[model samples]
Target: MTDNKQPASNVEDPAMPEDVTKESSQQHIAKDNAKTLKIRKVTNIILLVVCGLFVFHLIADRFIPITDLGRVRGFVVPITPQVSGEVIEISVIPNTLVQEGDVLAKINPIDYEIALQTAQQNVTQAGQNMGALSANVTASEAKVTSAKASLKNAQVQSKRIFAMADKGVMSQADADNARAELSSAEAGVASAQADLAKSKERLGSEGENNTNVKSALLALEQAKINLERTHIIAPTSGVAANFRLKEGVYAVAGQPIMTFISSEDVWIEASYRENSLGNMKAGDDVEFALDFAPGKVFKGKVAFIDYGIDWGQNEQSGKLAQASGQTGWLRQSQRFPVTITFDKEIAKGFKRVGGQADVIVYTDDSSIVNVFGKLWIRLISWLSYVR
Candidate 1:
């Protein structure tokens, strides 16, 4: 009975058809094709994203300006003396703040004082000479007047003698003598006139306008200027640096005695690659950070861009340069300086001439690009601590 039951179960179970198997295989193939297409679409999307990022990077690099090659700069004034003298007293110390007109040092004023006195004496002597010349002129005029009176009297006598001689009342000898006297008086008057002209020439148009007086006046003015210069005063308000002057040190005229770094103003000079200045313009907003003061940002604006670079080359001198042979495929970019003036003075001790700094320029470009640039700048500023 068990064998019969097994045979009857086998008869009831039928084998699967070839068409069904084929249909199942076809469904598996379709599913595989759809999966492959979805994978390809995902790959294409990812590739597109990568290409977009690369293009954005290229654009940003060209448009957004940023540089870490920055240095603090300010006006450095060289203190020099206008007159040569031996320093008798030293006033200010090194690295000390001083105001304009503050005395820095003093020279031996004795010599200058003597010079002034000499000038004064010369002026006085010139005045006295001028007065004497005037007196001489007056004397000459008086002599001329006396000579004129004598001439008039001589002429009257000569006429009367001639008349008397002609009328037979006087001798010819007397007439001749009277004529000779008139001639002598005329000669005397001419001599006096000549002397008066000479005296007037010496006197000049005015007593003060005499050549000697004028020259002496100029010397007097120069002496006063030298006397004032003996006290070496500051030309501008600033911090005195490298003041190595000492008492008894002989200072030559126009020689720099010390350096005065102007504390009233300061600026930053940012050096950037030449190609990075295309979008930059004067008055563009700038942000900078000093390495000395970490995590602090400063505001500034582009003042000017230097028009030249010190590339160790000069204008063609007709001689060909000995060029070095090409060693590599890389070419270094040339840098240019850009001057940036601060919006306000930074805190004391934080400002240093030639201090290292990072700078970023905000151009009126795409706001999106600007946003990214600002973020990068802030990040760099924060990182200035470790760097």
Candidate 2:
């Protein structure tokens, strides 16, 4: 026992014990560090995804669509009368639907029919006159032939008498008479040739723009116009608008007895914010919300964009300057108008008549960004739940 107690004074195996303890402590620390590093990596990845989504959402204005008035549109119509006549019957009323060539009114055909008959009579008379003229030309030619024969006989007689006079056997007066007759015959032949030329000119084909032919054609045209006027037809297929016409109403030339609105050419004119213009372009996908049907949404593409803003009567900001010589300033928003037309059957479902509509324009390209935004939203919602 005394000897064992004496070992306190002696040096123990310090290196061996110290090495074992240090090794055990280091192993524990390394295990803890590996776990901590794993947790930190997972947290960093989650944060990076969240940040990406946040950025995408902030810039989604380029991709996410906004609504505007740039999509509404319509068409214009000009009222025209096909013929001039008294209105006898009217078929379509105001706002009535009509197809192409549909009758709108009727005109009295009696006057036109009479005019046609008169024209026909005139044509026949002209033909008869031409025949008579031809016979006259033929007679003039015969006269020329007779004149030549007489002139030849007179010349022969003149030569014979001149020979006799030279020989002192005939008088000079007879020879002079024969010479005068021959001269007269030559003049007559010339007149006949002139007459023949005139006849040929009359028989020539009339050019399309010939004044006389045009006049005759105009007569035929008038007859045709009268016939067409007997039935007043719509120029195009559309709905009758502002029509005050009825049976027995007198219609004048260049007067609008009725108006027509196109049924199939309806469109939306939408006004978009200037700030929302960056992402919007022609042919962009769009959604429409009509003012009439608040719940219904229509689909269309951006058909057009205004080149500039138009601020009517009231001067508003960002209105494009009016063109030179434009009239009075009316109070209206000076915004660029865009045209949008619906192609789907859904637009038909809504009762739209010059209806007001708003549009959402889309302007972005990255699907990954959209996905990131979605994930971020989900994460935010989950975090809120956790909280």
Candidate 3:
């Protein structure tokens, strides 16, 4: 029943070592293999950990963001020249507070005063000529009336002489003389009337004095303007600075001697990243801190956000480039400016033009899902899952 079969459990070890030296080498090899397995396990674990950290950083950068749009600074100005002359008086030094209409300096107004005098003389002369013309006109009227009376008297005499000659009471010679006298009187009256018309016309449309009067009036107005320009007054309430000018320093026409920055029209401009602005609005809370004046905080609401990158991309955007120079990839995260105005408290202390400040804006929509909250939640989840 068990023919030609070997017993399974009773078999002897076929590859048994015959010497002690051989058995020792085999045991050493077995030990080395175990150590290699441990070292490989440690290396693989380290690589996995480093890769995971890199992936986490890349994802986190997408959720949280920051930017700086640099500081903005400028000054105010009214660039019209009030007076045209050498500067005689400089009352305001650089960096002074000026109220509205305060005199900053004065020009040599002598020329303007002389101009006014000349204008006055012209008006006076024109007025005197007009007076003389009026007197002549009145005289001409009186002469005309007297001549008309004489003419009437002559006509009556001529009619009486003609009647007497027809009745043989006067000689023909006497009648002819009477007629000549009447003609002479009539001509005198007509001449006087013509003189009156000439005088009236001389005072009005045909007169030389009318042109003089108009010219004098224009000169007077110009003189007044020039005289008023003698006083250089501030156009706005502001802090004045940058005075490279002083008394007797000739400030040229339209040249800026100094600058004034208006305190009334002060506002802050803050720039935020384009990617981070998705949830921002005009009514979000904005907190600001000034670098110029530390420990001061200003509160404001978001005034507005810009439409797009105001400075457009290079001309290579939608065209084929022959050869492009170093127009690198635009930052996937771009920033646009946002304006924030100070609350009334800002006016109380540091309300000034060109004051610089750092700003932070937060939206109500970012309550639990925002960067801060989301990071805290993620930390907790990662800790739990890893454990």
Candidate 4:
């Protein structure tokens, strides 16, 4: 074809058009690159959001700490007998429920009864003695008055006799006799006055107000009190625990015979990390779970925070030692006790004192975090049933 036309290389190829193929390949590559870039940007934004949420959760948990370190606390009253006597009867058994003023036990009352009778008799005797003294005072006063009248008459007779003797109308012997009578009557009056004074002193301010009567009254009251104490009554409404009294065992004064776990009130004693107390305050909301009632969350409020703890206490030596220095690579956080009061009634028969519990505190701020915190406590409560 070169003799008259161009070579075969110069002929156009329809199957492999250069411009169309290049344009199509370039469009496919551009579309793939754009899709990849869009995917990468979405992945980065998702990762940033996830990381931010995790950091917020961590910070919230740190600020509002929760712990499983808690115990049920209430008043544990010791059943100490005020008076010493033999136990004759026991009305309640160990771990039995009792009410305030219910007789827990009875002591032998014969001795106390005898004491009361003796005290009464002494009081009566004192009253009688005081009455007699008052009567004696009245009698002595009357005698003093009569003796003074006699003394006055005797003195008048002596003066008249002396005047007659000086006028030669009466003998000196008569005047001397009259003077002796007057002196005797004066001595009698003085003696009667002394007796009256003695009687008045014995009578005191009045018969009932005498010192002896007052002392006897006090003794009588004490005896009555002792008699009443023979029946050991419950101090409050609660359950009696650790009771070991027998029918004839001697109950000593001021010695505890049993423990009364008072049901009048109950509370939670929770220990939290010291670092977590920066915002912890009374009246803050709290949630708790009891070992006795697992899977159940209880509501409460912070009642108080203990001012101190026995971290350095040495019970045997009766002194507190300095807090031990940080010894290891890891430092332990100090814990402080916080008292929480129940907002609602606990399950009946849930032994509160000394029972284990898990507690979490919710501060006043951050409602969103508090919602999550509440969810966590409920989860813990459910978990408590299993573990």
RMSD of 4: 7.2
Overall local distance difference test of candidate 3 = 0.70
lDDT of 4 by residue, 198-312 (tens): 9998888775568999999999999999999999999988888977678989999999998899977878889887878877889888888787887788888999999888776
Can you write out model 1's per-residue Cα lDDT over 75-173, one digit (the tens) per residue? 898988899989999888887778889998898989999999999999999999988988999999999999999999999889899999999999989
Q: Supply candidate 3's per-residue lDDT for 226.
A: 80
- State how far residue 343 of model 4 sits from its true place (Å): 3.8
How would you encode candidate 2's per-residue C-alpha lDDT over 29-61 as one tens digit per residue? 999999999999999999999998787645665
User: In terms of lDDT, which candidate is stronger, 1 or 3?
Assistant: 1
Which portions of model 4 miss their true places by more than 4 Å?
Answer: 1-54, 310-324, 327-330, 344-348
Top candidate by lDDT:
4
Error of 1 at 159 (Å): 2.4
Best by TM-score: 4
**Every model's TM-score:** 0.78, 0.66, 0.60, 0.81
lDDT score of model 1? 0.86
Which stretches of candidate 2 lie above 4 Å from their native place? 1-61, 68-72, 197-214, 291-296, 312-334, 344-353, 364-387
Clashing pairs in 3: none
TM-score comparison, 1 vs 4, better candidate: 4
lDDT of each: 0.86, 0.66, 0.70, 0.86
